[model samples]
Target chain A: MSTLRTEEMTLNMGPQHPSTHGVLRFIVRADGEVMREAIPDVGYLHRSIEKIAEKVGYHGFMPYTDRVDYVCAMFTNQGWGMASEKLANIQVPKRGEYCRAIATEFNRLASHLLSVGTMGMDIGAMTPFTHAIREREMINDLIEELCGARLTFNYMRIGGVAWDLPPGWREKALAYLDHFEPILDEYNALISYNKIYIERLANVGIISADEAVNYNLVGPNLRGSGIKWDIRKDLPYSVYSEFDFDVPVGKGEWGKLGDAMDRYMVRIRELKESVKILRQALKQIPAGPVLAKVPRNFKPPAGECQIRVESARGDMGWYAVSDGTGYPWRVHVRTGSFAAMGIIQKLSQGLMIADLVTLIASLDVIAPEIDR
Target chain B: MEAARIYQRIKDRFGEHVLEISDHQPDPFIVIDPASIEEVGSFMRSDPELALDCLSNESGVDYKDRIEVVYHLFSYSKRHGAVLKVKLPRENPTVATLENIWKSANWMEREIFDLLGVIFEGHSDLRRILMPEDWPGFPLRKDFVEPTEYHGISTVRESPIIRLDPKKK
Candidate 1:
């Protein structure tokens, strides 16, 4: 036998690849099946959304916020609305806050379903995706009835929500939640505990709790790393304080504590928590006006404020500065996906090339969310 | 810890570096000298009482007169947060990188660099995170003028309403 020489090769994974979930690219350095590093080359979907906020007045920016993270648009809407409300010191009516919470929790369910479903699909299980999407489509229909649009539901406003819950909508939402609760077990049976899926994700791309917090991971991602911090629970934002729900953290049942499977399981567990929140919100929602009264030209005092919302992906931070003008002086959205993407190159070291998809899906890094 | 108490601690530690504290109605912030940001960041992160472990949000604003970089520091252990700002001259806004103290600042500084043209000295990987590498100017800057065209591709599209004007036809 003769000795052979080899060199690492470079490969481009996306920019338009099926497993990426959105327009994301990865410059992968590979030696055979294992990767040396997978550097994320993002911003393919950059839409200058933050700049647009400076041009459009505060109220006009609500619709645009929905596009920030279409998978869980309600949180983005709530984040922007909360930021503006904080800047102006406008109090959202109790009913309106309930509406916001109800709509956002439903959005979280839809988002987690898509995430878990896509994780299965990314790992080569196709049937579970159809099942998850089937449940998600129903949520879409319910949200569409609450707000005209489904994906980009601009259901929130600076003071409160755009409208009150539609006629008999609470009963319909409750019915949907009732039907959706049992489906979690079905999903688990189908995919979550599948032998091959566990083999693929277990003990892969483990991020310690300290690393998660140091990287500024939020929402489910932080929980996945065994950090029991949820913006809704610990920070106590909006009606989240009023609603009773459990915050689920990953236990590493089948793998290392902070591995991909742990992240996947955290999202699955959160789907249940979201259902619980929705149940409480729908049952306990008080009767009153949803939209608060405000002047046509809405401009807050010259001040800076930031609002944190527990979006499906993670903790979404919206920092706004108003120079006492019709339009905001500056608006910046520090999204979870952007922070998640930052850690990919570090995590991708020494992983199988195929497992890169697993890493990205586990983090649930949506493109628009990263770019915005 | 309360923001005012945190300010007092920082002031006691770094007297000259702490420029001013605006005890505003909501979200009071401490303005620190750009030169001492890294020192303050490390102090805020390591000090047990002020264990601001997570850099929750970092953003840059073009105030026309000056460029301000805002850091929203949060502590998961203590469950409290503080806002810090560094005002740099508009012409060449530069600040020391906080990436060493808080890993989250790596990408955030790059974003500030990309969008606002603020330089983060000693950043390990300082490149455009959102905009293209060769984009003309920082789009987030207040006085930035969008290029009429990029790479010979027209940035502007003719409005259909303008094209459909009967008077022009």
Candidate 2:
């Protein structure tokens, strides 16, 4: 059978498009509407933070970690803090562990709410986005009470946390948790189960478990593909072993095991687990020093270390090489969003233009994390 | 499969090809010759017991005399990790690509090539992932200096000179 030859149309999705997240551009080769290939163009936000690690001493680099991934800055803060601690062999106190865990869980809650709500908005629903933002504001307030800033919290310290909980902050955080647990249900009713939402997300942007693992997908994306991998539960860190929590993986509730809906559902289920972890941390936290007393000229022995953190995105790895000096010899941050970038061109091969947006939203690839 | 065991297994399998195995400060690692990286990666990916299916992170470090490439590999099934390192001469830092073994290494290798200037021998598309393709010199190297300007845009920031504001002074 003879067929007509057609040229693929070139479409640019922006270093400025609202949907591509931040500064991420995709040049898609499309045959009419279906994308033949969508090669991603990243690095718009690269500030050379790793190079800065050489100039700035260990402590001076804390705030920069927040910029590495601001959506869930607390985790990156903790990641860097812990990496430094590992390098120096500093032991964080019991109270410090509880504070780090509690703050981290709250940050996780805020990050997931934004991810879910924004995905909803990206899929044509707007109300859920507002609802998600409303709940997130409460978290912002709670975090601000603990640390001064709201969005970029350089809260975690090298040995401990930057600040101790303010007077009555615990009571307020517990109240917010009580209020927040019920909001997850409201989120489900308002947008999670909507017919249009399900149809738009379900069975789209499928990533097989093997592909997920092979791609080095971290956090929920790998778990969403039914691979039971989580640094928090698997390779326990920061008193996480003491707490009881469930690791949620995609069971293909609406479609195949690793579809857009599966990844979305994984984040939704994570909200419940985060709340559970928060409640336990709040109850178990004991009174002690918040900041560990590290020396002024802190120099870790010459060595190389790789610290993995379960941030909002998949595995966030901080690799640091110290040469028995105050400054790190070399610092490299390998983020989940960076790994996820490899899959976009593969996933976008046969998807419609609209489906591509859904895939981007479902993957939850943030710009700064990938470009850092 | 602890890191020590994994190192031992790799040492046993590859004998003289293994350069040095050490349990340094925090983690255990095995330094291997750069030429056998692809083959080692293949066995690591296909082996059931030591199924290192995930290439967590690949980093290139620059010392004065030599360049070091570090590969952090993890096995989901076995719940184990191994750090594979290769030391290359500073003149021509080239290591065989493991992109075929772990698809994730595709962009990661490119990034190292872009920022650190380590050449990945068989990377499918080894181009700049972070910096512009034509960007001058690898910025991560210790000896690299910041350019004064780029495309007429000033790259240096004015030093914060002690100045008295007319109103404050």
Looking at model 1, the pairs that clash are none
Model 2, B23-125: lDDT tens digits are 8969778999889989888988898879998999999999978999999999888888999999999887988999988999999999989988999987889
Question: What tens digits encode model 1's per-residue C-alpha lDDT throughout B1-169?
Answer: 8999999999999999999999986899999999999999999999999999999999999989999999999998998899999999999889999999999999999999999999999999999988989998999998999999999999998876744667773
Point out where model 1 deviates above 4 Å.
Answer: A1-3, B162-169
lDDT score of residue A194 within candidate 2: 88
**Residue pairs in clash, model 2:** A218-A314, A219-A314
TM-score of chain B of 2: 0.94
lDDT of 2 by residue, A21-86 (tens): 889999999998899999999999999999988989999999999999999999999999989999
Candidate 1, DockQ to 2 decimals?
0.85
Task: List model 1 lDDT by residue over A1-372, tens digit each.
Answer: 467789899999989999998999999999999999999998899999999999999999999999999999999999998898888888999999999998988898899999999999998999999999999999999999999987999999888998898888888988988898889999899888889999999999999999998999887788888999888888888988887889899898988998999999989988888888888888899988887887779979999888888899888899999999989999999998999998999999999999999999999989999997
DockQ of 2: 0.89
Q: lDDT of model 2 at residue B96?
A: 92
Docking class of 1: high
**Native contacts present in each candidate (fraction):** 0.80, 0.92
